[model samples]
Target: MIKKLTILATIYSLFSLSGNQTLYAQDKLEVDVGGALRFNYNLSSWKEGQKNRGGDFGYDMFRVNFNSSYKEIYLNAEYRLYSEAFGGGFLKQGWVGYHFNEQDEIQVGLNQVPFGIQQYNSHNWFFNLTYYFGLEDDHDMGVKYLHVDDRFEYNLAFYKNSEELTFGGDSESSPNRYSYDVVGRNKEVNQFNGKLIYKFGDSIKSRLGVSAQYGGLYNLDTKETGSHNGLALHYEMNVQNWNIKLQGMIINHDPKNLPGESDEILQMGAYGVPYEVASDFSVYTAAVSKSIPVKLGPISNLEFYNDFGYMDKKVDRFEDSFMNVTGVLVSAGKVYTYIDYAAGYNHSWLGGNFVDDFSVGNPDAKWEARFNINIGYYF
Candidate 1:
């Protein structure tokens, strides 16, 4: 009788281990949790006496990403817990799509717009002038198709409303800062973006691409309509341990009525500007970086980079602006840090938070300095 009981116990133990293995094989789900904490020590000065020096923090949130695959269908979702302005939490990216092989896919939801570059070339965390114009690091509610092969890579997208914008009013519930939109008055409608890049050469890898965007803005109050369109050309190359990138674009804004419109009325899209007529503008950006093979303590790599940007608004009484930045980047596993010195004149878009000249009616075009130390850690 004792021998019979031992045999039964052995059978039970083997079956339990086999069942656990079967469950693991049938339910193949992958989950990753990662986030970043960004801190900054800034000393910035703009107009005389308009200066501030202090510590700042941003995007300090925890994120969870989930993924699962069933044959040709793939699912992805991400959620974040961070600072909240409106009622609900912020949604960075969430999409479900079909994989047409390993190189192509189509996704629908909030995704990055394929405009100039996927991620602009800059060591500084603030990005370049294009971001201020709603072109860089800008994501919207849209449908996107992405394809990549040996010859070229492409992205085609169609967006709904131009994300939410804060409209007129000093009411405590202003949503302008949250959403990079106008005072809730002018909203972009029927927007489309397309980008394509072709790669060639074996030894010297080079890529060139052109991008375009077309959209319309509507003023809810006056029922006025405006149109915006632009074209951009970009080029990049990799040489040894150095990388070089360049991009140029032209953008135009055409409103229904120019001078006849309300003088002090809040204009949508373009910030700190009076829409007098159809104005054409241009922006040029360039950057170069070299990676040095040196390690210090926890630092695994060191890089030195320089970034420059220039903007020209072909309008009377409006002066052109330019910005230059030089910085050193340190990478230690999942942690990265940048120490930079930025100086510019009338370049409000490139200025740091405390050195902004956007509010000044007419900037004196005087050069100012920003000593910035940005540190970020990811897990």
Candidate 2:
């Protein structure tokens, strides 16, 4: 099935490429390809009192993007490849669009669901700085419609997704059960999402967005059926050198399980004092990140940055799971290099229980500290 999907994507890409040639005389075609190399060192990998230290080095990503615009028509395609160790491989995105006028357009194809800012800026390393607050949603093959004006923009999308898993670990073996967020069986799922954004001239930029998805899970053997639903709210603001964003999500089940469990989540973050020290230098950029569990306590974190062109100075607390209170002060002239350090009390929280299982181990809570160094490039 994956191979067939890849072939279909290739065929679609060729079709779009050929269409670009005759779409419009004023149309333009563009292509982008880039990759990132990173080496990370873990100070503490052993649980609690054990000492298991190791590091990873590899190409984090390799991706190609194609975009074309012809008069009132537009098309885009992207393909990405990465190491299998990171659960990475190849995925494709293809979409075709038409502009009714300067401010209104509609697109239909395998496209992105406009649920979060980070989801739109996947190619960036920093991930727009807002993504760290946990608003990143997955992409889907679906139909989408978008409307954009001077100050207001809106997006609506519907998509379907399917997967097959055998709990016994053999590919040919049929699993005893099947489930999905929207449908009870390992069948196609119907998803719907919508977003609205309002920009307030130079003073403040704000957006209010909401999304709800519902469907059923079909059991293959017993033919049992289960239902699932997810709802979320997102808001963000940018004032001067300060930026703040908040998001909340409620799920009635695993969203992937036929008879999944229910869970709720809330996350928020803020950054301030983005000052420029020189023509290509900046200082005093600080941020705070927090997450509140539905029934557990809150996790507080902080991050600091001083970037100067190719060089950056960073210090923060537990950027993600398996990392804690890490700090890095590096100077990259042409080659990227940095001396990193960190210390924290715990690496994670929640004791790895039902909540972790429901959310797929997202928003991991851990406490620890470490130090390391590496060199890399971005082009």
Candidate 3:
């Protein structure tokens, strides 16, 4: 069993440009520890052998999270363990934060980047297509600042690089990471991010935001650095128990490769694998879901959703890519289960060799589908 503790600490006042926040001499430190265990079962249309064997079911991951706070200072971290085939084990995120006041705060260390629809843009376990391009739910070693108000939110961050102390590989850019990033002959560096969000509405609350990223791409062979830029617009709405999301983004990576290397396609890697991706592209995604109260004994609620994304490469000869997922989430006490059916065309994770699908995709390749179920229990 995990232990929870609250201890008295010497309080310190946080001074800011505006004023000083007074803290009592005696403040209590609050700590909470929790985690989850997950499992997965999947059947893929592209895997004939897997279908013949009636699919596969196995352990997915085990993770632990720690959070503590005292006065205006706080810290949180998460570590995860997965099967060796999925990159073994690594720290997801660990950061220390401080509150200048109720509206302003700062975080330092490994933290999620401020971008797009926030922690996630899709409801399914697979996430949205933007995740593969390093635009959604991406985390890096950096510093972050946040400002919040009644109707607006602002985030600014500077990331020196991705988490380099990952599980596998001895190279400068390791593939055993939780998020996709520039790997192989190039790496991401000196990245800056900005996001602004506005909230409004009476009966139907809505939020609209824009995110921007600018970074340098360092080519190992040439020892020269190039640049990358990305811009995105995201919107979400909640009307009663119904939810909707829409997003669009454009990304460009210009790597200064060696004389013989082509810059048309850049390499991105994660989860102990590398794949090719188009250098210049635009992505659009839409997702919707509705929650319904359930009375199936232990079951409490059900959420049904559909998510879709499309990628349009700027290169004339490159083929397009798309993914669609329909799923349902069942919540019962501490256990949550997701049943999903996903289909993709020219997508990397979905099918078709799983290598150059995001680059010059196989135009002759047919769409592939996968049936998946993921269940997790929280403590």
Candidate 4:
């Protein structure tokens, strides 16, 4: 953050010294500052002790956002502060963009990868299972080009690498990040992404898109570069106030590891923790939601949604993973809340053990449930 502040100050000084007062006067800068404070209550079926002791409610996160623009140049960034156990503080995303007319633009710096869906594909707070695998809404340090028209949209991006933490010497990448990335002995680098979306229909609008990505997995132990690739087909449709989303994807990872190291699993880290994942897998997801407006005192509207995802491993003896979430979002002026009942089987972020749940998980593991409610006030 200090670095960003210094850069802004330097730019101001240079502009003032150049005596270009008219240049600034012609394009008055616009800025908007906002933030949110959130809290959560959770009760897990797997955590018998916590359930017996009457669940738990605590602070979730506090985030501040900035959106500023001077003519065709714009900047957007967000900083978040989580609890110490949840990775402390980090920059969620920061990017500078330039507009070349209405049809084209470019974004530079840490930005979202143009893969899977735009912005986000899920309706609930937990998102879909693809998010945990770093396939949905992942961000990295890179540059991207975007083109949009009435019927088509195109995105092309090249990421040099994932965001790195300078203070952690023992690991190649920090676990204290908002998005999951390849870590441990291998790091994600030199990634290329392309996506195309076609929009059609009138009253019942629909969008069909295809996305693909290829990247290098640099193995620290072997000092060699391996490869990984993914392809996805996604479709979204809206009829009346109902929304439907569907997606399928295939991914493969090949890493060069030292002798005796298994190649079937890779390490992925985020939120200040590391976990194992199947190197090769296929994912399928479907979701539906309905928006209804009501006059329930302070409650103005409600959105009911259900999201589901499945992960099938390619390894011969590996087990599959599944996740489902049913919830409703309540909106009352500046206050918003989500009430969710989420369940999973052989899922890492769910109920199973942390590190190996997505790797070679138990084939007979039973489904576990977690009931949660999250509330936030935005300003």
Candidate 5:
């Protein structure tokens, strides 16, 4: 109840101030509401020798975004409804921000952690392996400072807690789940994230950036404490209608105390215990995309893309994993679609093989392929 009241108060204060300021200069006030409706059909190969066989239609996502601005003050929020069995309405993002100048801004509340490429460059709606490791398109509650100019961009942030977790019988993550950050541990305490990027060239510009994250990982079971740190180097370039990107990252999760001579590792993410450990792992990704002129019905543009990714874990009997995705995107006004074919091997933990279900007996060590299509409209 107290938390709810505080959130309400903050929202009320923001609106009150915005309304008062906008009244003085009503012409500067702006309000916009937008959202998307998505549908998906997937054909997945579960085992080593399987054909594309299941036919299911899902009302994947319905999102509503609201944005209001009055001079330097702004409010941005989005709510989403998913069609999954365990789905309902939730806040995807909400923030209040103040702009000091064209190049400087500060935002408070739940915002995206400025890590890795945002929104991702993937044909699949699920993104890639980096998401599972909390490296791509992840959000947290924090205060963020952003500075962007002609040559450089800077992002510095501090977060109170990590992503929210659900518990008990109705919990999104149940016993021994293998998706999302359901470990219930590894809460962020005074977490700090910083990123810097440099842009060069004119027609063929290169975007290069280095990012780092460091914070405490608290355990819910033992009330013990741990720490996790990550470093990444990312580079992207666009030439004509073609765009290319590459990223590499190293992450370490170190427990404050470990049993003597235990030789145990603290694993994170959907892998749960015994598989994911308090060790270091590396991920590398590369992707290329090109826009081509194509007209099919209302489709006026098409984009072809390929994404390659690999992850290596330093554990015995655990083979390295890789994913290769090739697909095309079709666009027509507010309508967009994706047709992708993805194949992978030995990425039981870090890839799409474990995406839908993370049960104990699920096939994780087998080769798999999937054909996915997503259609959506913005309104």
Candidate 6:
């Protein structure tokens, strides 16, 4: 009887182990989906010379992620959908990744170039208020590798160049009107990036990284070629209640253009903020409640903060030149509410000679302003 009882217990233990293994295997294949919706109202002109004001509400992003692992092999897939103000849906990202070993992995599909911090900033809804400086939401089909270990991480990728479509005014256009292929247009672009992170003490840490890209353009129609280069410097530090980040970039556009064709600039910015607030519920009795606290839950769980920003740029003889200032105030919780205001002055320059002065006069640069309010929910 004792031998029979021992046999039953061993069989039960084996079944339990098998069940646990099946559960673990199931958990390895996981899928998730999420997205955001945004509504924007533009009380001012869209750009410099336009006279029409507008507003739009649409899906900001709809994305899904798939992760699976079998034995020593791993796989990942991500997809994103977006719509513009004019009403059309487009695929933002579609990518797949494979893991060969614990420390190395490769990905291919449409993905963002792993270049700088600004390219991947996650703090704000709109990336840095201006879309011109950083390569915002720009991606291409490519292959990437990631080597991650204890003290260092490296990312490298080569991707199919993206293409831009140009259209003619006020009518249906042919699919082959004018297309700019970023890859075929450029000779070859290779991006290299690395990060060095060190931890000193329990609460303080820092990281520094440098990234660069070099490539040339190839004109499919004209068979012309051009070169391009971009470099960035990034650094961040976290200490106690403060976190700081600094980034800078130097870019040369159309370097292969004639004597005055290329445009180059150096731009940089830094941000620092406290990690946490001292008071759970604090009311400021001021003219403008810079910090407002509203009960997000039974406990004083959530708070709201708002700020305004302004910038002005002045350049002559440039088609896309303008001077502008913008401000935004936002609140957060289960839902987000925000307001944006912007104003700008725009003008054009025409070449002329001193004596003859055979040049058209600059039109009165228009003054444009826009006010937008948005409410969104996320899960």
lDDT of each: 0.60, 0.39, 0.86, 0.85, 0.65, 0.37
**For each candidate, what TM-score against the reference?**
0.77, 0.56, 0.93, 0.93, 0.81, 0.57
Q: Give residue 315's error in model 4 in angstroms.
A: 0.5
Worst lDDT 10-window in candidate 6: 277-286
Q: What is the C-alpha RMSD of each candidate to the true structure, in Å?
A: 9.7, 14.0, 4.7, 5.2, 6.8, 14.1
**After superposing candidate 5, which stretches have Cα over 4 Å from the reference?**
1-27, 47-54, 84-87, 121-123, 165-182, 256-279, 348-364
TM-score of 2: 0.56
User: What tens-digit string does per-residue lDDT give for candidate 2 at 88-201?
Assistant: 543345577777776766666655566644343221123222232222434455777878777777887777542223333222212111111112222334666777777554
Clashing pairs in 3: none
Q: What is the lDDT of residue 103 in candidate 2?
A: 70
Local lDDT at 339 for model 2: 45
lDDT of 1 by residue, 94-200 (tens): 55566677788877765667888656645565566666556676656678898989999999988875444343432211232212333345556668889999998
Error of 6 at 29 (Å): 2.1
Clashing pairs in 6: 44-369, 44-370, 161-183, 185-217, 185-218, 186-216, 186-217, 186-218, 187-216
Off by over 4 Å in 2: 1-25, 28-54, 116-135, 162-188, 222-225, 254-378
Q: Backbone collision count in every prediction?
A: 4, 23, 0, 0, 5, 9
lDDT of 2: 0.39
- Which window of ten consecutive residues has the lowest lDDT sum in model 1? 15-24
Index of the highest-lDDT prediction: 3
Ranking by TM-score: 3, 4, 5, 1, 6, 2
Clashing pairs in 1: 166-183, 166-184, 167-183, 167-184
TM-score of model 3 (CA atoms): 0.93
